[model samples]
Target: MAKPTTEVALISVIVALFLVSTTFASSDAPFIVAHKKVSLNRLKSGAEKVSVSIDLYNQGTVTAYDVSLSDDSWTQDVFDLAGGNTSKSWERIDAGSLVSHSFVLESKVKTMFYGAPAVIKFRIPTKAALQEAYSTPMPPLDILADRPPEKKFEWAKMLLTKYGSLVSVISIVVLFVYLVATPSKSSALKGSKKRR
Candidate 1:
């Protein structure tokens, strides 16, 4: 019985040391800091184009492998990365490293507004470490529209389009009241002949 207890205690100590070493090793995993910016360009046809710029920094001791940016809002057909992307392998991002990428997305003028919500997903070395250092609800980019100046004729046309029917109806009523209130020329002549 004494020999069995000694063996059990030795095994427990070995397991504890292994766990402690593994924890220390994983603590040096890579950490990622991400930032994004969005901008809008108004086309000559009155359509808007969206451009997104992203910057990622690896602020850790180990290299981050397979780093990529992904979002459901990114339309596969219209999305264009600065450099052509053929595979998910982005090489490796070393410690204290900075990487920048830009993408041009499809135009969504009517739907795009100030402080629009967007989520960016990243593939990093360790999800837990990245999440701990990552900040949420990033500042939204402004959508600028270079609208043409409104002309006087355009304002007049808009007013007519909105209130033209009301104006016509009022004009007709005024004409009818004026005709009823005024004495006719023929009646005036008859009255003058009777008085003479």
Candidate 2:
């Protein structure tokens, strides 16, 4: 009786360990290794250039296939891929391997504020995986139109740039009007003496 009880306990322990190991193994499947960087570059024309770079690693023991990256807002007008179409693809990423992709996109500064999120999609023999990469808020562009003057000097510069000619013309007209309206002091004194 004692021997049978010991055997049963040993079997139960083995079964628990097996279950835990299988769960861990499944959880370690192919997934995004990391989001290396996402950044925005502001252009002088009040447009924004966006770049997203990411690394995809296969943590599982099997190769990943049909890997692609997508963003709903991505279009031919804005994104020009280095080689492929709207959805980037890789035939296969081997087990314990990493792949890097960089995307360059262009848009108006205002449009970037409503940009879409990026997603990684890949498939394995057993199933497909879709993961969302770490997204950074699109940085506001510092274009001349969007950024307000921070210093008094900047404000003065902006005003001069915008209204310099108008201001100068108005000043000239005011000076001419004053000169025509006011009689010379010498002329007024001469007339008064003549009258006396």
Candidate 3:
């Protein structure tokens, strides 16, 4: 009688685990992810330019609808829009799809600027509430002060870092060829001297 009761209890536990796994596996939803990148370029005219690029990816099983992206982090006095709009919208992004947006900001004044994350909003047909997400945040950027004159030593160091290995390889090959050729010439000279 005890063995029969233990078998019944084991069967009941197995049935419960199977039900829970199926319930979670049946859920299908759309998940949106955003990544933001910022680059600073120094121009020859003593102005700094900030380039911003944002990428949106849908990692969910279903398609996302009514997608929008907005970035209003820079102040009007600090940055001027050089090109491209800061806000964009799309009708939909399919499952496992990617979209990208970019803009450039030019700042003539030298100062430090703090940035905020870009906002992303989307909707699901089955859900009433609008889903919201934010792109990755960026740290503070220093647009402050004038860049000093470039030194020759600094330029040399940069060149060395870029082409030092290639130069070394060429030098080694040239040295090896010279050493091999000189040995044959010296051997011929020694043979002539012995004959004389």
Whole-model lDDT values for every prediction: 0.57, 0.61, 0.84
The predicted structure with the larger TM-score, 2 or 3, is: 3
Cα RMSD, each candidate: 19.3, 19.2, 14.1
Instruction: Give the TM-score of each candidate.
Output: 0.43, 0.45, 0.66
Give the alpha carbon lDDT tens digit for every residue of 42-158 in model 1. Answer: 667655566666566776668777565543344444343434331222467788998776656544344424232233233454464333222122333334445577586987899
- Could you give me the TM-score of model 1 versus the true structure? 0.43
Top model by lDDT, which number?
3
Q: Which candidate has the highest TM-score of all?
A: 3
Clashing pairs in 3: none
Residue 179 in model 2: lDDT: 93
Over 40-150, each residue of candidate 3 has an lDDT whose tens digit, in order, gives 999888789899999998877789899999999889998999999999999999999999999999988888776878999999899988888777666568884566877
- Which residue pairs overlap in candidate 1's backbone? none
Can you rank all candidates by lDDT, best first?
3, 2, 1
Off by over 4 Å in 3: 1-27, 144-196
lDDT agreement of model 1 with the native: 0.57
Question: In model 2, where is the ten-residue run with the lowest total lDDT?
Answer: 135-144
